[model samples]
Target: MGSRNGKILFALVGVCLLVGAGYVVAAALGPDETTTEARPQVDGAVLAHAHLMVRAVDPANPRLNGRVYEIDGGKARRRSGDLACERVYFAGGRGICMGVAPSGVDYRAQIFDSQLRPVHEFALTGFPSRARVSSDGRYGATTVFVSGDSYLQAPSAFSTRTVIVDLRSGERVGQLEQFDVTKDGKPFDAVDFNFWGVTFVPGDSSRYYATLGTGGSHYLVEGDIAARSMRVLRDGVECPSLSPDGEQIVFKSRVAGSERWRLRVLDVETLADHAVAETRSVDDQVEWLDNETLVYSYEDDLYTVPADGSGEPQLLVRDASSPVRLDRGI
Candidate 1:
C-alpha cells in the first residue's frame, strides 16, 4: 500500500510540473503590456510641412486605445515616455488624452504639456469618443458615450455627454447638456438634447461651435463660454471643424437613412456648403492641415482632401487616427 501511494504522489507532481510549464509558455506568447510604440511607416515628405500628433491604431484590434505618435518631415515616431490614449488632441502647447484609467476598469482624461508629459488627470464618465483642445490651449473638450440614456431603444443605442474643461487648472468648466440652447433667438430645450464635436474658433477661445443632436436633427450651435449659452446656427451639420483661418467650417453631413456621412466644407459667413472630393462616408471631427486642406481618419487610416471640394482623397498616414495638426509650434 505504501508503494502504491508513492506512485500516485509522483504522478500528481508530474502533472503539476507540466501545468506550470504551459503557463510559462503562454505568458511568453501573450500580448506585451509594456510595449507602447506603434512604429508606423509613413512618408516623410507628406508630413514635412507641419508636425502632426496622432494615435496609433492596432490593425488587429482597432479599439480607441493606442500609443501617441508625432509625424514630422514624413517620419512617424512614438512620443517618448508613457502616454497611450483612446482619443488624443494637441493644440497651443497643451494636449488632452482620454483613455482607460490605470485601474483598468474606469475611464479618465489626462491633460499633458508640450513634452507629452501628463500634468493632470481627471476621471471620465464613460467611454471616450472625442477630445479636442482650443487653439490657444486654454480650454479642452471631451465627449463620451453614456449607454443607458440613449433615446433610441435599439440594442446599439447610446447617448453622448460633452464637457468643457479648463486646461490650466484641469477643472470641469461646464457640461454642454446643462447649458441653455437657443434657436432663432428663442430658448430651445428638449429632453433628448445631446451635444458633441465641439470646435473652438481659431482666434477666440471663449466662443465655440458644436453639434446639437435632438429631435432627429443635428444643428450647428455657436456657443459662448462666458455666457453659458449656445445659439443654433443651422441644421444638418455634425463634427464641425473650423479652418485655421477661421473663415471656412468643415463638417460631416450625415447620409439619409444611414449611419455614414459625407465630408462637406461650408463658408462660416455665408453658411453655404459643398461636398468635398472624397465620396466615402467619414465619421470623424475633421482636422485642417491648413486653410486649404482637410485631414481625417477612415478605417483606421488617415486621409487628406482639399478643403475647396477639389482633388481626390490622398492617404496621409497609415494605421493612425485622431490627427491633430501641430502648426502652432507645439
Candidate 2:
C-alpha cells in the first residue's frame, strides 16, 4: 500500500510539470491566431467611428481608382463600384456620388445610405463637377455645365448651372437661375445670370449661400429655398462654404488684374473679409473640418490650413480631393 501511494504522488507531479510547460509555450507564441478576440490593437482600431478621406487614385487604371482612407492613419481601402466621379461626399448618413453615366453622354447622381446601399438616383443634364450635401443631408447641390445655356464662344466656361435636390423626397429643386433675386431689397433680373457653389445654413434647409454671376461679375447671394428667392450679399467672392458655427463664409476671391483666386473668409454678421493662411492661389472649393481648420485640394492632394490665418498648410491626405467630414456626433 505504501509503494502504491508513492507512485500516485509521482504521477500527479509529472502531470503538473507538463501543464506548466504548455502554458510557457503558449505565452511565447502570443495570443491565438484563430479569433478576432485575439487580434492586434491596430486591427481593432480600423473598426472605430472615424472619418474617411476619399479620393481618386490611379487615374490611368479603371480597376483600382477611388480609395477611402481611414482618418486615424489606418490602411486605405479601395471602394468597389462604378463610382467614377470628380468628387464624392457623405452627410446626414447618406453618400452622394456625381459623375457621368456609363453611356458617357448623360450625367448621373447616385445616392447611397450609410451602408453604401443604393437609396436614390437622378439623371442630370450635363457633365457634373462640384457637389455638396446640406448639414442634415436633406438637400444636395451640384454644379454642371449645359451647352445651350452658355455662350457659344466659351461653351464650357461661360455656362454653369447649380442644381439642388431634395434627397429626402428625391426630387429636383430647379436651377438657381430660376430663383427670384432681390438686389438691395429691389427686384433684380438678368438674362445672363448664373449660380454655383451652394452652402446651406445649418438646421435650416430653407436658407443657403451661393455665388451668383451676372454681367461678367460674381456676387455672393443668400438663398431661401421655400420662397425660391435670393438676396445679393457681397461681390468678388466665388464658391463660398459656410463655417460650422454658421458665422463665417470662406470662398475663392479673384485677385485684381490677375487670373488667380485666393482663399478668403467673410464674417457673416459684419460682412468683413480676411485672407486665409495659404498664400498660393487656390482654384477648388474648400470645406471646413471644424470652426478653426479649413481643408481643400491643391494639385490633386488634400491640404488643411488654419482658418484663423495662423498655421502653414498641412497635408492631410495624398492624392485625395473633395474632403468631407461626417458629423456623426450630430
Candidate 3:
C-alpha cells in the first residue's frame, strides 16, 4: 500500500513540474508584464452562498483541452467543458465571457447563456489567447499576433488588442490596437519567437498589459488605446492579476539578477506596494476572491493570500493549471 501511494505522489509531482516548466518557458520567452484599487464591502451572507463557474477538464485529455464546470453547493459538476475554456468569467449573473482555444495559433471569444451553450458562434474573431470579460458582461478584450515577413531573425511580435463585443447584439464593437510589444516594435522575421499571456486592465477601457520578450530580457508594458501607445509599467512585472473589485493588481517580480519570483501587490492610486509571497517556480495565473483575498496557481495547486501582500497562502485546489478563473460574486 505504501509503495502504491508513493508512485501516485511521484506522478502528481511530476505533472506539476511539467506544467510549471511550461509556464516558465512561456514567461521567459513571452512579452513582459498593474496597480490595484480598494475592495468593496460585502456581507458574510454572500460569500457563504457563493458558487463559481469553472472548467472541469477531462484529465483523460490533459493536452487535448477541457470542458466547463459550475461549482455549486461545494460540488463541481460538468456544465459543458466542451469549449476548451481558457478564461471563464461572469458579469452580473447574466452572461459569461470565455476565451476558447480552438487551435494552437488561434483563439476565439464567445459569449454564453446561463445554460452554458454558445450564444453566438462568431461573436469575436481573431481573438488573442489571453483575455478577460468585462464586469458587466457586455465587452470582451484580448491580445493577438500580427504576423508579417521579417528582414532579420527576430521572432514574431503580437500586438495586444482589445475587441469590444456586445453580448446581446452578438456584434463586435471594434478591435482597437493597444500595444506593439515586439522588442521596440520589431516586425516578425523568424519562426522561433512569439508572444502569449495578454491581460487587459480591469474595467479600465483605455489600457491593458502584456509581456514583451526579445534578445533575452522580458519587459511588462501597459497599453493605451486612446493614445495608440504602449508604456513600460515596470521593467520585470509578470503574472499580473486584478483583485475582485478590480482595484488591485497582484504580480510577480525579479530583483536584479535573481530569477526568484516574489509576489507583490500595488496600490493603483498611490503606487505603494506590499510584498506578500515568495515562490521557487515562476508564479503566474493569480486571481482575486474579493478585494482583500488573492488566489494564484502554483505547483499545480491554487492558493490564496491577502491582497495587500499579507499572511501565508492557503491552498485552494491542486492538479489545476493556469489561466485560472474566479468570480467575485459581483
Candidate 4:
C-alpha cells in the first residue's frame, strides 16, 4: 500500500513539472524570440581570448626576411620588428603601439590602434615596472616600482600599489584595490610574483583572477573590481590563466623546497588541481588553446602540449616568449 501511494505521488509531481515547463516554453521562447550568446559586441567580431606574434627581433633569411608568421604555419617569414600584433596574427589590423621606456623615461607602456599603429606615447610618473592588459584588452594595469628611503641600512627599491587605466582612451581607470582577508576568508601578503597577470571570467566579462605572492606564500585571488572585496583560492601560485570556455585555470606553482614552477590544472568550479609539467626554472606563462591543449613559453621557445600532459611539447619557435594564440584571419 505504501509503495503504490509513493509511486502515484511521484507521477503526479512529474506531470505537474511537465505542464509548468510547457507553459514556460510557450510563453518565454515563442517562435519570434531569438536568443544570442553575449559575445563579440565590440565591432561585431568576437575578440580572441589572446593574441600573439612571432617575427624577428633579428632576422637574416632569403624566404623569411621579416614577416610575421602565424603559429599555425609552424615557421617564420620576413617582417619588420615594427609589425603590429593584428597584422601578424589577424585581429587588430588598424595597428597597435606598445609603449617602450625610452633611454631616460621612467617606464615603458605599449599602446596601439585597431590596426596596431603607434598613435600615442607617454612615460609613467612613478618608478619603472611591469604592465599588462585587462581581461577584455580594453585597459592596461601596471606595477610601478619606487625607491623608498631606509635610514636603517642600504638604499632599497620597492613596488607599491598597482595602477589600472583605460587601454584605449589612455585615461585613469583608478588604482587596483589592495587585497585583504578576514579570519574566515583568506589572508594574503602581496609578493613579486603575485599580480603577475590578470585574467577575467569568460563570457561574463566582469570579475577576474589575480595571483598574489605575499610573505613567501602565493595565492589565487578572485575579485570583483567594482566590489572591492576578494576571495582566495590556492596559495603559493603564479600566472593564473582562464581556459577559453571558462572552465579551467592553468597556473604555475612551486611545492615545498622545489625551485621549479610546475604547471598545474584546476577545475575552476571544484578547485581541484594536478601537475601538468615541471621545468627546472619557473613556468610563468600558460594559456589554454582549447579545453585540452595549452601553449606556454619556456626559456626562449614556445611549446604546445595537451592539458593532460600526455605528449611531448612541440616547439612553435626558436626564440619566442610571451606567446598568445590569435586567429590567422581564417
Query: Candidate 2 residues 146-235, lDDT tens each?
Result: 444323343222256687888877789867777788889998776667687888898887799998877657889999888888999879
On lDDT, the leading prediction is 1
lDDT of 3 by residue, 31-98 (tens): 21100111112222223423555443333333223455554454455555444444455553334444
Question: Which is better, 2 or 4, measured by TM-score?
Answer: 2
- In candidate 3, which residue ranges exceed 4 Å CA deviation? 1-50, 58-61, 92-107, 122-129, 144-233, 255-260, 322-330
lDDT of 4 by residue, 1-330 (tens): 111100001111332343333233323433322111111111112123424554322212111112343344333332343432211121223222222233422233446544445545455544322344544566555544333323212233233345555666766655544434322454533223224456667544347776654445667877665664467776755768778778888887765665456787888898888777444453445766667877765544556666775765665455444444554562
Query: Worst 10-residue stretch by lDDT in candidate 2?
Result: 1-10
TM-score, predicted candidate 3 vs. hidden true structure: 0.61
TM-score of each: 0.87, 0.78, 0.61, 0.65
Ranking by TM-score: 1, 2, 4, 3
> How far is 114's C-alpha from truth in model 1 (Å)?
0.9
* RMSD of each candidate relative to the true structure: 14.3, 24.1, 12.5, 21.3
Which order, best to worst by lDDT?
A: 1, 2, 4, 3
lDDT of 1 at 78: 78
- Cα displacement (angstroms), candidate 3, residue 82, comes to 4.0
- For residue 108, give model 1's deviation from the true position in Å: 0.8
- The parts of candidate 2 lying over 4 Å away from their true place are 1-50, 59-70, 73-75, 78-82, 154-157, 328-330
